[model samples]
Target: MNAPTGKELEQARSSAQENHRALHRRISRLSDDAIDLILRDARSHYAWKDQPIADSVLHELYDITINGPTSMNTLPARFVFVKTPEGKARLAKSLKPQNVPKMMGAPVTAIIAHDMDFWKELPFLFPHEDRRHLFDGNPEYCADTAYRNGTLQGAYFMIAARALGLDVGAMSGFSNAIVDEEFFAGTTLKSNFLCNIGYADETALFQKLPRFPFDKVCSFA
Candidate 1:
């Protein structure tokens, strides 16, 4: 597809804004099929175009994802944008042998991470009593909160990408320790997952994977 012209890009943004407004109005009322499309049709996309996923789009994506929830609102997810060659090289070291090609080939990959010391600011994020003390003696609480909230934010990233007509390939097949040491250095952040963001190449998709039957996967109780 041709690159969108200035006018064309603005028009697209206007259209997207309108759609966002419409979706926001009925946030909890999405049809079952629409919700399924968001979950089921969402795939771990790999192939990408030569065109970049612009900085403006990344900003919009963050604006959408930070709206997601967390226990006591302790939003601990941190994102590292791996766009530069040096940065990509760092990420490449941790990727599994099978994931190397895709990670290297994608236009951009986001390193979703969790901050181990996130509770330090509980006075700001939790604010109800000295909740920071709740996590001080128990490191597992920090681990659990980071893992759960980071995963939720990662899922939000995928949904926000789809909402903006972009595709993502999210993967966990990487060495977390290597990533933490190489990219995050001395920071408290632990790597959670990698998400490749860009337009799709449908021709490269394999056959769709099967899903478990609802009867087997869900129960009213």
Candidate 2:
């Protein structure tokens, strides 16, 4: 596929903005199919079909994911989409042997990371208030806020992928130190986890794993 030109991308962005506006006008809750697509039927895929994901789709996924709320509107997460052979090779160095096959099979392996200096962006990301001051001279507070909010964004990314008819498999079976050194060297970004995104090979999946019943895990406050 040809790369999108600057003009084409701008046009796409304009169309996407209008589409998002239209979505806001719908006040009703999602139907059962939507529920299934986003969660109920979604599985952590360990294998993938031999297909490719376009960059435009990734852009749309990110656009949706960022709309999720974060503490003080501090969007602390950064993502590296590994699609090239070299990129995937470097990423494989961090994965456990059991996880390597699945990661390499994925069309894109996203390195979800948190910027330790995310507070510095608050002047623009959260311009309505001076929340950056809340982290001044406090390394622990900065670390906590970044990691917490970054993880939320990573989860949001997976949901957004599912909403776009893509499958995701999130994994922690990797060495963060290796990932950080390979992909984010000399930066404040710290790797949180890696997630594979693509069309899944359903035939390779085992039956859905059991989950705790609502009654077992939930209670009215």
The whole-model lDDT of each prediction reads 0.84, 0.92
The residue-by-residue lDDT of candidate 1 on 1-221, one tens digit each, is 14355888799879989998998887957777766656756676767777788899999999998888888788889998898899888889898888987777778899999898888877776543567877897999889988998899888888987877788899889999999999888778899999988887776799888889989989995
User: Candidate 2, TM-score vs. the true structure?
Assistant: 0.88
Q: Which stretches of candidate 1 lie over 4 Å from their true place?
A: 1-28, 31-37
Candidate 2, 1-221: lDDT as tens digits: 24345898789779999987888777457889989998988899999999999999999999999999999888999999999999999999999999999999999999999999999988788655667778988999999999999999999999999999999999999999999999999999999999999999998889898999999999998
Every model: Cα RMSD to truth: 10.5, 7.7
TM-score of every prediction relative to native: 0.83, 0.88
lDDT of 2: 0.92
